[model samples]
Target: MAAKWQVVREMDANLIDTALVEAAYANPALRALFPLVSHGSLQFSRCTRFPWSQDLPSIFPYDGERHFRVRRLHEPRGSGREQIGGAVTADEAVELVASHLPPGCGPALDGTPDDLESLS
Candidate 1:
């Protein structure tokens, strides 16, 4: 899981989309979650299929099936508090997202080559 994640971090949008599409085709859980990610949309949204007006950072719709909605949000600028359940906090939530950290992203949000190295 980490390997794929790291490799994709260094990729461009086209590559990322292709990689995600391939992964979704193979993994049902990923299939449901991958598409809803808006292209180049920095702002987070709930991972729900049904729209509900709420100020939540994002939502991940989960069903009994292996496939479900899952979103990964990034932390704020220079904030030690990591994102927990899409909210900034010291404690780790069930999940966290590395948002807007694609290739050519800002230094603060960019995925470093070291991140890939560490995973290796």
Candidate 2:
């Protein structure tokens, strides 16, 4: 089957219900994918890539399963870029935000470009 990629515009703090944070974190896939959701979230048009191939919304509906809506983003890629985001747990929020920082340019920040961790 063909892959489906969702270009996430922003991380809706409101859409993220507190009750399901732990469940999301428990799943290894969800934890690994949270970072991508946080990337380039400074602006709406920034486009944070996410994975929505597995009927995630139907399986793990947010909030009331009908009220919660994750704004689906447009992908310029011919088919898809690949699903990269998911329901972020509360504890992962801090780390999630930090991982999406702008890239470094000065020497004081860190070593070579290869050593940098920020996504830019």
Candidate that scores best on lDDT: 1
Cα lDDT over the full model 2: 0.29
Backbone-clash count (model 2): 3
The stretch of ten residues in a row with the least summed lDDT in candidate 1 is: 87-96
lDDT of each: 0.31, 0.29
Instruction: Quote model 1's TM-score.
Output: 0.24
Clashing pairs in 1: 29-67, 45-58, 46-58, 46-59, 47-59, 72-97, 73-97
Superposition error at 41 for model 2 (Å): 11
Candidate 1: tens digits of C-alpha lDDT, residues 3-119:
433444445654234333344334323222312333422122222223411222333323322222334333422223223343322111112233322333221212333442364
lDDT of 2 by residue, 2-94 (tens): 011122222354544333343334434343332222321211112223222211111123244322223222332234323223454333433
What's the true lDDT of residue 81 in model 1?
27
- Model 2, residue 92: C-alpha shift (Å): 20
